[model samples]
Target: MEKTPLEDWIAYKIGIRPGSLSREAIEQYQLARIRQTVALAKEKSTFYREKLSGVNPIKIMDYVQFSKLPFTYPQDIKENPLRFVCVSPKDIDRIVTLQSSGTTGEPKRLFFTKEDQELTIDFFNHGMRNLVGPSDRVLILLPWQLPGSVGDLLRIGLKRLKACPLPYGIVQDPEAAIAAAVESGANAIVGIPTQVLGMARHRKGKELAGRIKSVLLSTDYVPQAICQVLKEQWGCKVFNHYGMTEMGLGGGVQCSDLLAYHLREADLYFEIVDPETGQLLPEGELGEIVFTTLTRQGMPLIRYRTGDVSRFIPENCPCGTILRSMEVVKQRISGKTILAETDFLITELDEVLFSINGILDYQSTLALTGGKDCLTIEVKTERKNKIDPVAMRQVLHTIPAIQQGLERGTLEVIVGESCEFMPISKGTAKRMILDTREQQQRPSGIQHS
Candidate 1:
């Protein structure tokens, strides 16, 4: 099997031959870059200057010492994003403002220089080679209308790699999107997980499915069930990409091995830490993902907490690359919620619900009604009367937390189906378990208890 292209790219960026790329060489380079980043952040960024007031960059020699620095949170950026800017206003090329869920206050703003964005494009160029090559047409189902949007950057990167990028924004009409894909003879697709799954299961999906050779799912967690469906139906290679807007929109991607993500180690340093205690965890131990930007010039973040839950793979990849591999993130620390003396995650629902045939997508809402915690699931199906609520309830009962809540008599489960397909709008946020117990009105949906 071919190794990850990122190994060669990282070696080139670090001024070493690809054959000489070793873990030791990468760590040495990362140490130097970390020191440089700390010094620069202290000298240029107002937020880092105060945050690292007592620390001397020269004295920080190893990763252990660097881990002592205070972590930067999303709240810190939302409080005053301008303070994190390491470059002058004129030098900054793009400013991405993100409104986090349940936040009514100021949104987090991330500044990026042209150079910073170019690094992302370069990463995308190499990362995409794992799925596509020259002249391969890829349908981009991400926001591309904006200048610095991920789709736009991906289009530029594909151009650099001599691939054709079909810039179709997020899926608003699955049929139309599928038609476009077929008309353009798209060889591959890059899209949100659920949206792509919906399209593949759509009525007109089979027309394009047989033609699509590969797919790259990003922006949200890629459910294994979704990958299975895509692979089974389309007979295509399914790749999961791990990234966020804060990581300059390009972090890591899966290689041909399809086991885990090959990290963008050339520009960022990643660490897994215990979520509650904030202590570093050993390799292969699941923890919150924390990252520090080593090459970012506009906003050099130091050990920013990602709130994502994943672990670094301890063993070498079967693809023969030495680049660090992280397991595909399946949960977030913030996604866990407690109700009726039990806790559950949206991911748990994803695993069970998406596996059932005919189910395209679903929304899970937990609300308190009549002194009981109610979990309502509104499902979208391929056809009317295709889903059996009894079977659905049986499948849902497989979840230990749900079973615990139900056996305690403090919770109830309601399942309903809607054949109407709802194509996700452009820039739609990730789907989460909505807790609406405090609200007076329940969500408008077909509910059956």
Candidate 2:
């Protein structure tokens, strides 16, 4: 018999008692868990003991008091990883290493015990319940070559739920991934947004029409434009998953309501704070997202600051789940651009350019051309032989954002040959905004932004 979903188990353990929880009861449960986690961190972790010195977890009865705790920066993890490990070396089950975008400092190394890893698997099992059913096949586009990687963990959860998983790793070959999905009778796909977009674009005719029923877009933000294209082309529901390796590979996911993400509140505490000041913000206000692990036993992070920006939705979700939901995460603080005193986020550009048909990949850079600040967008098409530049330009002009910028002389468009440009993030990672105005001039026809 298929086991119960992790969400149901969590609800039972927390005494949520479906159809009976008041807002006050939920908040009380969260506060009690936070207090327990704080006590554990101070007792076991050397780094937290020093950082949280003279602090009494029992006295932290409210949000304001909890916010007073010292914040954990990424640099601390990078400089001294073992200092944060709560468990002995012998007890460690696995170590996950993530290299910072070379633009930042050194890579961060995170340690996890068997229990810590299982929490994430549990979260995946619960979150996927929103989209997949027993006997449904899920195509995993993350790496699973290693023993305890994200894909491998997800495979375990899918098997527990009685759903089949195709662990194809990342999209080294979009065509092959699509072929495998269709041949395997996959009804759901889990992957990064860009690769999934490529797969949807490359899918010819009705080959994938009835096969794919849903997609759990993970590892990066899913642009509205990309979601629009996938729904129109494939006729499938798209659910966005927000997570990072630091946050245990799974954080939150959107339900059928599709308004916001129902967070993993059972094992994690979420907070929003001012990016510059580090002061906590009220619900419904946008700020940097911070997280505290309530259940991770190996390397427990207290008040760990995540650079991504988002806010808590104050209203209840239409789906009727009692867990708190968060707004769709926006671009990082550093990715915002300024043009004619008008601010443009990288996601804005992604929505406009990616929605156009035939464009497979793209890069947006802000540059100074002829002493005028200009937004230059470069795109690569899947089929260069079949592309009509005139027709493509018309399609680009149809987007209100791009068309407005072009009409006002604030933006420029350049279509490049396929594979001409690569992202700076390294190895299949897609970074839309690259500011090149500060760099030395490039040779002719090579735009800098």
Candidate 3:
């Protein structure tokens, strides 16, 4: 195993001395590892062998050539998952089956060895160190029933660092979650963004206003409105974590500087590409995120298209770590829309809706009505009947961009006590904007909000 230390604090956990190599040396090391991974996958996995048939791993040499290798799409995994596995069934330590949110597709299964699980645990341990301390009692709000589930893995990491972990599972009851945190003396909380926001708005959630010191929002997109609310209401520093089940659970975490994510470059290679053309995009250009596992042994995904959209932030972080940063990831390609010659993203709608005082949840849909393009947004409010047209307009006035969309007749507002059109469950993928103007076929089985 080859290693290059990027930070002093990270050196001990990742097994590399701090600043031992220059930027050039680190790239060289990564390229070498990439070659090794390609060769190993080609040798052990029939899928990789056929996909990378003519490509000579050793002669490929650079990133450009590496980029020439065929991409592995989600459909390939969906159709022939077993062919991608490099290890025997007996050696697989854990298997995570994730259902697609579309409500009509088969689940994607992710395999991991014990060593692979440890790598993710190592990532959690080091990543938690950025937002927590040895004395801090952290509250994990995800499920922990399975042996290698997210919360269970995180608990193991926190225990390894001498930090107390209070695993309360998912936030089924916001009041109860708050009570557990208060009783356990929790200083930090981790969970999905919506659940965390729901907890923050609860009357009891406000009771922990000054008690909790930090929050880590994950799973779905973390809206600016939610981030602002969490910071103001809880008086805590908010951080974002970007990860997926296929990436062995832990991928990247934001540093204390709160710029962008400091990627787990040691375990995975990240790239951005044109969603339609599949060509590599320059830094700062919006595109699909592609990843290749450099150290994963159970099943090394080569150039797997993640479908999540984001860009690489080229600047060095003020946090002083050489590890690269990525722009905050937003909704998948299916959730993006161009309404009446104006663009609308789920994140933008979230910012507009969630910032309002009475709004609890919202959903936007684009449709063709009477030869006109119309965007109908349904907002669920905390005050129920109190959310009349006058109150709704006042709240909508806060966002100037949305106001422009309204004036142009591209946006329409519908305020209600409860929005039946929107799926409010915390378990499914959160897709706030649904563009029904076109036969909007959602990605496989993932549902839209």
Top model by TM-score, which number? 1
- Relative to the true structure, candidate 2 reaches a TM of 0.88
In angstroms, the error of model 3 at 446 is 27
lDDT score, candidate 2, position 285: 97
Residues 1-449 of candidate 1 have per-residue lDDT tens digits of: 99999999999999999789999999999999999999999999889999999999999999999999999998999989899998889999998877666424566788999999999999999999999999999999998999978999999999999999999998877889999999999989999888888888887888875799999998657789999999988999999988888888777999998998999999999999999999999889999999999999999889999988999999989999999999999988878878666678888899999999888889888887677789999999877888988999999999888999899998989899997756463442555787776553545443334
Best by lDDT: 1
Indicate the worst ten consecutive residues by lDDT in candidate 2.
421-430
| Model 3 stretches astray by more than 4 angstroms | 1-15, 367-376, 381-383, 386-412, 419-428, 437-449
| Comparing 1 and 2 on TM-score, the stronger one | 1
Q: List ranges where model 2 is wrong by over 4 Å.
A: 1-7, 15-22, 102-104, 203-205, 367-376, 385-413, 419-430, 439-449
Would you list the C-alpha lDDT of every candidate in the order shown? 0.88, 0.77, 0.77
Model 1 residue 221 lDDT score: 76
Instruction: Give each model's clash number.
Output: 0, 2, 8
Positional deviation of residue 154's Cα in model 1 after best superposition, in angstroms:
0.2
RMSD for all candidates, in order, please: 3.4, 4.2, 4.7
Q: Estimate each model's TM-score.
A: 0.95, 0.88, 0.89
